[model samples]
Target: MKNCTLDLLGIKDSRLQFDPKYKNKVTTDDFYNHRKARFIHLLQSYPCFCPVCGKKMKRNGFKTVEMVGLPSGGLTNIFSIRKQKYLCPSSAACPKTITKLAEVQDVKANARISQAVKYQAVSKLGQNISQKYIATDFCISSMTVMRFAQGVSTYLKPNQHYLPQNIAFDDFKSGNFSQSGMSIIVMDIATHRTLDIVRSRQNTYLRSYFLQYDRQARWAVQTVTVDLYSPYRAFIHDVFPNALIIADRFHVITQAYRALNQVRIQAMKQAGHGSHNSRALKHYWKLLTKDSAHLDFKHYHKSRNFRNLQLCEQDIVERLLAMSADLRLAYNYYQTLLQAVHQGNPALLEELTQSAAGLPDPVKKTNRTLRKHRQEIKNSFETTFSNGPIEGTNNKIKTIKKTAYGFRNFENFRLRILVELKNSYVSLNFHSA
Candidate 1:
């Protein structure tokens, strides 16, 4: 016979994958409820001495302790432990005077679920799973899931004392109303880890909040990437004098394209709102936003509408630009600026900004704004830094919030983000807790 063979019957229990620790002492008994399989584990203990007294004691009786458990046999689970109880013949023999129960395994006080169940639930929480689902899966209450999430967050939480040399800053909507909070997150650009979060993006509050960090940590920062927010730019200047501010290319293009869209709208109106040119302009709006390099100049229109001109994306853009000289100038400037940033031509940017007198008011305004932070705009060419990572992090935060139905407290929301971020990349372990 082989030394080891596959236990096909043992392979039948899926709960084993959930890490059942007390295998030697716990026995599994399962039944069906409403045609659904349910698991019950009977927990008992061997005779042992009290840790405090270190004196062997006879097992006098058993007390039933029920705990939430992971799913087993493709169904729900329940654990009923016959927890051991020992009687000290002489009260003086027990060193700890108050306790009557002898410990067998570690479990949280006044908690129905075992630590194992809590752990597995917390691990799922980090994946942005709904608490209701976790509660049902682990046979626990939603509140217990919340408590576990909070603990797991605290465990994997980063050190707040340090901010890395390269950093990115961006704000996300915490609540919808004007009276609601505006939350901004600071991230370490090198490690791409979130540093900390603040409840408000207001200048006064942000300045005061960042000022509290260690001076050396502030000085350690070498570069900061920011969106077009002037206050954020100003805040970085004052707080991190040694760091160069790099305006993210994505934000610059985003703002420029926003202005370009306005120009396009004006072109449509000039073409007559209901006219063929204007309708084509609206239908081919996506064509304008696309990169010219990707445009198929020979491609023909397939749809049969008002005009079957069979114009490719490039041809459509050219026709759209021909609608108005002002629109042409704005589109040219938008494309040129994108190229300048991309090709690292600071001189081109300077020329375009300085000669903005001929552009539409919107384009001129955008150029002026870019020129105001001229040095930061130029700095984008020096390094690759973007709030791109911030988008991914924000998506995770949004997922966590949505899954939880929504967090009423900002601190809990913040904690959930912190832990959930870590949870995605790191496996949950007892040592981590």
Candidate 2:
């Protein structure tokens, strides 16, 4: 910025200059708008050529229009352009006679907002700025802001419908609460981007949507990784019969941990809330859920256990383990499942599945559920794919919903998702790879 200059009245004045890139774009200089709403400038176009004859053209009169311009330093600008109109007269060789208005590269024809301003408006959405605020900042109407966002949505839409080899399916709540109370989000597992968001996730809609894909697109899918949700599995079976259904490792392991935590909670309650076992369970729950192989507890000098009065760092876990048989069994089962998954041991998984009969009642419920999908669970170890990336995409969807405070139009909400996939944290090019 230039140093502030003080007039005799003690008001500071400053001068502004255009950047070198934009200097050539403007022929006449800039001035304050008459309404004092923005800084207005006059822009000129290059030499005109006759469209009909492809010969040297004559400049007739000017066609002027107002346009929103790019902003800088918190100051909004407007452009008033006088486009050159060339006359192509009728002749035997070239009979057509017409007047064509010169087009500006930065602004679309008949558009009130410049392309730069429109793009900036859409970019501001990623920063969690509301559309109303962007409109005020750009000196445009809120409707124009929506129009800009819609235009951006159109640009970010996928160009083709080629089937993804590996994909994941998930759902999230959207603006329209009445239609289905939630929306389905389909993701390409490799890119970790949302491919589409539909208003419903029911079987009827899902079948119709996937059926729209050409036969080649459907057949190209080789694997579909999902949680224990039954609908997606059934849909894959019906539509893409050859694809292997792999249950996500994270979801399966999460179920095991949840079941073990239930057993721990039961033990704590039986010991009483204020009792030794209950207190240890409450404070050291993290230690119980953590895998034994990953535990890194260390002993500090002279730190005595509350129960046994002996030096120990894992006193809580030790005390709880000795007090409850069901809790210990559940913990053992949880660890065994995790180990089997990490090692890709189907034999150990089969052994664990058979041993579910002797498990704690709470854990047995989860174990039974896992066994029901044994084949899918086993497929997880054979493939490197999972819903981990899709889960991350869901996290982004939550942020988008929170940023906009919820969307009412599902169409606009869908577009916003496309914007995020193309421009947000990952910056992935779905098919560009």
Candidate 3:
């Protein structure tokens, strides 16, 4: 036995010993008690100093044994920590005393799971997994998961310049009819990112937000594309005087088509069954709305009877598309309208009224609305920009909504969107940390 040391059993280390009596005697209780001391030793190895005071601390004693780990979601280990308290030496003046190391893991010392675990849970499951399922996976209560998710949400912070230069404004229904909720969204056109979102479509709210911005930011906006909402027009003029406003081509076309649909439906109702024109109208409805180039010959043949209605709709669509082109002097007039409105040229109003008179009732009505808010529409074309980015961002937001089922609490939803938006910009190298 040269330099042999004794092991825990007080036996010489050299011996390869085995006892038959010890085989059946070992039990769970024996193993647990044996590991308890080792677990405490492991905890002591990682000492926590007061973040504010920068002072070394000693354990006063075990305060309480708490379940302070994420429920084992089959992915991570669950922890039940025996919280130990430490008291600082300068207790009289020092604000915090008797701090607990377990607080790092547990959001609150008494919480059943650690904050890290909760975050992991959210990252892993998101909205796809139900709260009940999360609880079962983690072997924790659903309330714990909910609390953990909330705790993680507190860290998201909104940044400055959240709104982009070119933006899109749109309204979406937040809730069902009677309890109807409405939200107005602004998106960055270039990146298709949501720049800002407001819970209400109220003009006052829009005006207030713009009023808060300094003149430089207000003027920095190049273009805003939106539907023909009168209040939106008013707010845009009051806030972004220098910016161009674009009546989104999509919105204009959709509105026109919707009106055509109404007309078709009415016509159908008046016509008796088996009428050639009625059947023709039904067959040509799709052809009328669809681009002819995209339609197959079979569908074109089917629509032959309703050629006049289709021609009417097609002519309107083609004119609108041509308005977007540089060749048409109409585009020039469109841009001039905004400039004249901004310069307070009374002649521009008369010109717009004349233009309004030549159009069909639907186009005339739309033109009238545009004339009423001439300044805003003029601003749109003059601005030469659209909220394309913001619209793109809204699509992403919708995706997020769909992925998460739907969020009941708007605040949480808002925070999540903001955080995700910031994260996206950061990823694109467009944002500073």
Which numbered prediction scores highest in TM-score against the true structure?
Answer: 1
Clashes, model 2: 0
Segments of candidate 2 deviating more than 4 angstroms: 1-38, 41-64, 81-105, 126-128, 152-161, 175-180, 297-315, 423-433
TM-score of 2: 0.78
Scored by lDDT, model 1 comes in at: 0.71
Mark the regions of model 3 whose C-alpha exceeds 4 Å error after superposition: 1-64, 68-76, 82-111, 122-163, 176-180, 293-360, 370-408, 419-433
What range of 10 consecutive residues in model 1 has the weakest lDDT sum? 1-10
Least accurate 10 contiguous residues by lDDT in model 3: 36-45
Q: What tens-digit string does per-residue lDDT give for candidate 2 at 1-433?
A: 2133112111121222222334453333333332233433343445677766787677777676766676544555555556667776777756877677777665567777667677677777666566677777777776777777775444455434577888778776665543667677777777665667766877778888888887888888888887887767677798887788889999899999999889998998899979877877787788888777776556633422264454444555666688899998998899999999999999999989886767799899888888988899999998888887767767888888886777777777776676666533223542233
TM-score of each: 0.83, 0.78, 0.60
Tell me the tens digit of each residue's lDDT in model 3 across 241-269: 87677776445444545544555554555
RMSD of 2: 7.2
